[model samples]
Target: MSDTYRALTRKYRPTSFEDIVSQDHVSNTIKNAIKQNRLSHAYMFCGPRGVGKTTMARVLARTINEIDSSIDGESLNQTLNIVEMDAASNNKVDDVHHLRESVRIPPQNGKYKVFIVDEVHMLSKAAFNALLKTLEEPPEHAIFIFATTEPHKVLPTILSRVQRFDFKRISVDEIVQRLRKISLDEDISIDEESLHVIAKKADGALRDALGLMDQAIAFCGDTITHNELLQALNVVGTDRLFEFMECVKDHDADRGLELINTLLQEGYDIQEYLIGLTEHLRNLYIAHETSKLYLVEASEETKKRYQQTAGDFSRDDLMRMLHIISEAQIKLKDASQPRIQFEITLLKLIHMERSEQLSELLAGLQELKKNSGNFVAPSQNGSTQKEVKPEPEEQAEKVSEPVDETESTEENLEPQPLNPSTDSEAVGSDGSSPGPKESEIEVEAEAEVDTQIEEEEDDDFDIGAPALITTLARKARASVQSEKQKQTAPSNGAPTETSSEKDLPEKITTEYVQEIWVEYLESLKGDFPMLLHLQMERTKVKKVKGGELHLECDNSFAQKMLDEQSTDLQFKLKEFTGSVLRFNISVGEIDEKDKPMSVYERFKQIQQKDPIIRDIVEIFGAELEY
Candidate 1:
């Protein structure tokens, strides 16, 4: 068989530093060190697998020995001075000592005796100790070069004695360029798109790229296409991934799940599918901010797919989906069924929608209001303002009208009266008052009724308050109504008006004040639903004046919770109601007799109710205590 059948990767391995792909900086530094004759006794090369760690180590060894004709600027069959050792197999202290003893002797013919220790991290602890002394100080002609996929496993003492160079994962473009060069040299034909697929599959490892290329060439013959590469690799193409992403964008979980199932049936690994999906989303996220497609790997076709998908999703939605999928990936390892986990995660991604943060929601509401048109308040001169009143004839007609039987029946079916005394008199089955004790019950009932009424009136007031307050505040600010009316009035000016009218500020309708106050409270409820549930029953809006909103809660804990969230609360309120409302949180004394049981107490009560859990507890001899 020809050499072409012997895997393109090994056939085209880099023979010199310049021939190495995607690691010029590393290569250049090493080459310069050799030229400067400032070579360190020990050197460590670390990076991901197939990113040229071992290849570079071999090249470095040959380069120091002046074996490559390209580097020495001459064509000659040079004898090798470099000695390559596999530390993985020879990991004993004796092997290390033998190597050390050889290292102490000078090269027989070459300028330097370079010992290339591959997978040096695999050396035993004793072997490492034995090698340390030689590594720290070696013969003038000796050089120790270490290469490993995992540098963390190497002893720090060994690491400290060496010059370390980290090799980065090769980029897709670099891998593609290298692959293209190999294709041209080997007289094989492959499309640019197909090359891109191979490079991406390599995931920044040049060796992997070549290995994949070798597979693709064999599987598809010489003229390989993108589809062929995908088929051979068992990878879902970018188009399919984009299609699934679009389904997610449209919130079509079923469609997304169908696509996932199809891919899985096609023999794609669930883990690899997730990785590809994540990368697809990541590309879109980056594309949303940048027009540069190079930031993420892929061909022109793939880039376009990403840009289109990104346009279909908002930044917030995409971020949320990424988070959910990432979390699901973490859970997949321990899951009983990984496919189910993946499907569930995909469903979540599809169903995921953008939800504005509290601040953003408020801001959006405020913006909407600003664009709705200016608010106008009523004029101070009530007589001058247009007021709708029924004419005498209309009032007479209304008085003459008779009620229909349906209307009468509807009215008669009204809710039964809540007679405070009668309701309070009713005895509970346990012989306790239906309500709290007489004095406490009355106070609590009255407070509850007042709070309810206040809330209702506030809602009614808000509808017209914006326009009314806008007109009133503007007029007051401009002093237009007061100044103009003062000039038109009798020479004594406000002498005719009551002294109380002039002294007392324009009284904002109780309804309008209550409405704004209640709306502010509702806004707070949205941000802290749990806290709101606990406080709403016992909380009351005291007053809203000069943009200051006063509220009373039942205890200091509620007050503190509200206070802690005051800044955010104020911002949200201002956004919702367009009022710079301030909060005054005060604790109110509430009767604690009707307070709900604690969680532990509730657990105990539940155990008493359910036979199953109760039996489990009884069998375990568990004790319940308050």
Candidate 2:
């Protein structure tokens, strides 16, 4: 042995453009440009750190000057034509002024003088301004290469002037291949699993992989394995990640929490663990969605494992779990006990149920459409009827009232035909059903809501009724809208709305509007209690005459939010009252002497308003904090 050692990053760094891994598009383009003498005055290499940005810049610098880029050859950095500056440390007007002066001098040794500015985004505003003129029109003998991890921070003027090359995050298999090649070249004995562990830990950074491999070699001697590399790197094992996911999939909160305890004992950072677990879940989700093992970037065994377990989670379940975990992650930073916070989050994920109400409705609708062709012609009495075959659970939940799956809480809502008609009735003068209008559907939706309210167990403030009512109203509106779209498409591009939709009831009363408004507010309070309290609680129905219902908002803010939701609200109202009415939002005027406040604020205001309190404060010379 020569008894000479070098860091793997430097020892195996690509010298030529061809040797650059996983960035063939960049390398080929640069090579073609160089060979064809079609070079830009300034080039920008931007991407994530340790992805061969600075290295590529140096290669370009050498290639332009006809110098060897190999590490074994004379160091390319030593060439007089190439000037590499760390922009982060020297990012000021004076530094850029010096650069401008230097660019003026002609290259003595090479065709061009290459100035590589690493971390170019860190350049100060004044420095960027100073650089702009030169960058826009640089000297013929000077070439500028700027590299940054964040291209977004770079000025548009500077960005527009330069040729930008985006480097991709190297793939895991590519990193593993590179690591294995280096290990073999150095005569190191490491298992394939160990190489995989290093690659996974690198997270698409090839330089990180090399440094990790070097560290592994330094600590683990010539012979290394997966456990040793993981230990050396202080990284959590792949087993824990797979096991934790299994616990989540199984809804075994205890086991999931036990993993947390183990992580704590092992001194793994909680947030870091959460991030890794999230990534692991994402991989499983991808495997589930794509069914491509290669896309997962895991070992064949791990990919197989993911493919097997991925079926346990539907896309909605995975999305819900991700949301729960992300929320916990954000909340964890402020939490006094991170372990407890994460545990609760995991528990939330474990207990989460997918809300497939909309999905079920869509499925039911599609199934109805498919089976509509199988419907037999009407009986002699001229009435057509079709039966739906739902799952056993839905079949068992039969009640006196018909169940519309779109509004079903426990069962998948199934779509029932509004007008199962005879041929004559179906083919109307306009070739559409004239009977059982949207108003009839509204009645069915109301019945569904009433049944849902009756089924719910609630001792606190009749919330169930209002909530189910609003939900049913919204679902009925969707169904009605969908049916309307399909049936009422006009030949002349005019909507074939019913006369009731176009003309309002001639004599609508304020008392009736108030009643409807109260129910609407109740529905709001049921579904969005916080929002109701914040914006809609104090709204007053100003008038309910003609074709419009004018409502008074507390302020302009309430008017704005409610204005955005006006269409949906109008649809709900039309469904609720069986009448089409336009909703208009207006800010209400408060009495100049009467200050508006919340209940708590009003109680404090009352104390300030009392004359006795003022007198007592004056007599005692006491100050009170409310």
Candidate 3:
């Protein structure tokens, strides 16, 4: 061994334009310029850090001056024709003055004197002004190439004088391909997952990826695995992200907290973890909603994992999770306790609500309406009334009773004068029937109100009964009071039962209770999303016995939420089922199949069930939207 080490970034740096990755536009243009002899006097290479700006500047310098770019060649520093300067350190007015003087001299060996100024934006204002004169009137044998990450910092006049070539950030696939080539050349053994991890961790910077690969080689001695790479780089793998999301899907806040703690213990940066997490969620969203698996830059196994897990979360949940993570990332910069912030973020994701789709809501509404025939609103006297459509016999009896009472009252009323001065005026000046009897008028009014109520019930099915209850109460108050008076009459007769008492379910069953349970949940989604999540989605109907309804929840968070809303939930339950059933809620075991399905999984199920939906999904690439 020579005991000499050249880092992979420098060793594998692209020497020819063909070797440069993902910058074909710039490379191709430059090659054409070189071939056609259309080279500008000065060129500016601009892009992000570590994105081949300086490298391209040097390559252009060598290419234009007819110097060999082979790594085995003698150093270019020996030639007076090609010069490289670090403008970051040599950016004073005096440096530019010296450069101006050097430009006056002809090339010593090459066709032109090429000056490659890295970080040229660091040049001072006076230095740029000094350079402007030399650039405006450059020698025939001199060429200038300036490279900078921030091109805006260069004076606009200086920018206008130079031809600019923007280098794009290398794609993950290109970086991975380059890294694989390097690994093979260097005789290093690394798995595809390891390469993917390094490529993604590079974040479009090939130099950073090479640096990480060198670090991994030094740490792992050529045989690199994904786990070792993660350990060496101090990065949390996507497996950790998968685990965290699994915790979220299961609603296991404890596991979520533990994951955060484990990451902290492993010496992983929370900010980096959050960045990786955001990308992972993005990948999951892409995998869930689209067929473009190539968009996810990962190994086959990881991509499959992403696809499988993508079904465990809805797009809304993913979006919210991403939002939470982004907020945490921002807050972490100013947070007094970063770990706590991260913990809180994870907990929020774990306890986050699953979004209800509009179609699901509409379906639920339809089901509620379809089942509303069995539903009843509670009466004003704290009693339940079944919303039954009155039988034809009952309708006939009601109208006939009112008419009979009206006729009897009319027969009893003596004939009176027309009373033209009063509000009531007799017809035809006859005064034979007087204007109308008070009891007959009352019967007519009662009959009219009854007809209107029956018509309303027949049409809308009393879905808005609660909202209209007060109005209906005012209209029926007279009839109710009259019925009460008859009921209170001091006679040794048997008491009559009300409609509520007669229509109440003789015994509550699990099936009816579940139907009411579903209806109650549907009612919450529109008005109380949070309540629906807490009390509805996570709770299961364990059993319904008599007046006691036992419910089992998977976690304490849901149990606590249910407990807090127990009173209102029980009331709603009774209202929907027409039985005063009490909730016996307990935090206990729940079946996995009964758990809430993610958006993609639900859509998949729907697609499987409906051929039209399946065809639409296949034809139009339709995704389940929130």
Candidate of highest TM-score: 3
Q: What does candidate 3's lDDT look like per residue over 1-626, in tens digits?
A: 12589888877777777777788888889899889988889989898877787777667767777777663222665678877888999999999988888899999777889888889999999999989988977988888889998988999999999999888888888888999988888889999888888888888888899999999999998689878889999988888888988898999988788888888888998889889899999999999855798888888888898889999877777887887887788889999988888888878888876786443544445435543554566779975555545447544444433222332234334455445575344444554445465444445655655555546544443342221222453336335445545645568776766554465576778886776566577555312323234347657898887678898876554565566667756765665667567888887854676455655666788899999999998899875322
| Stretches of model 2 off by over 4 angstroms after superposition | 69-74, 249-254, 351-626
Ranking by TM-score: 3, 1, 2
Model 1 Cα shift for residue 433 (angstroms): 51
| Backbone clashes in model 3, listed as residue pairs | none
The candidate, 1 or 3, that scores higher on lDDT is: 3
What TM-score does each of the candidates earn? 0.58, 0.55, 0.62
Sort by lDDT, top down from the best: 3, 2, 1
Write candidate 1's Cα lDDT for 1-626 as tens digits. Answer: 26536666667777888888888889999889888988888889999999888788778777777674454311212334567778989899999888877776777776888788889999999999988777887888888889999899999999899999999998888888998888988778998888888888888888888888888878988788878889998876778887887787677877887888788878988888888888888898888866566697878776776777777766656666777777877899999988888888888777654443332444334433542232234478732222324347534433332222122233333444456677745667787655333333323333333334334433443321211112222222223224334544687544676442444334443355455555455444312332233454356778776767787876554576567666656765554444456888887665676344443455687799999999989899664310
Q: Which digits, one per residue and each the tens of the lDDT, describe model 2 over residues 440-550?
A: 444555455434433441222221111122444446544544554554477788757665455444556777667656666654432332333335666777887678888
Off by over 4 Å in 1: 1-4, 68-80, 356-626
For model 1 the local lDDT of residue 541 reads 76
Worst 10 residues of 3 by lDDT: 461-470
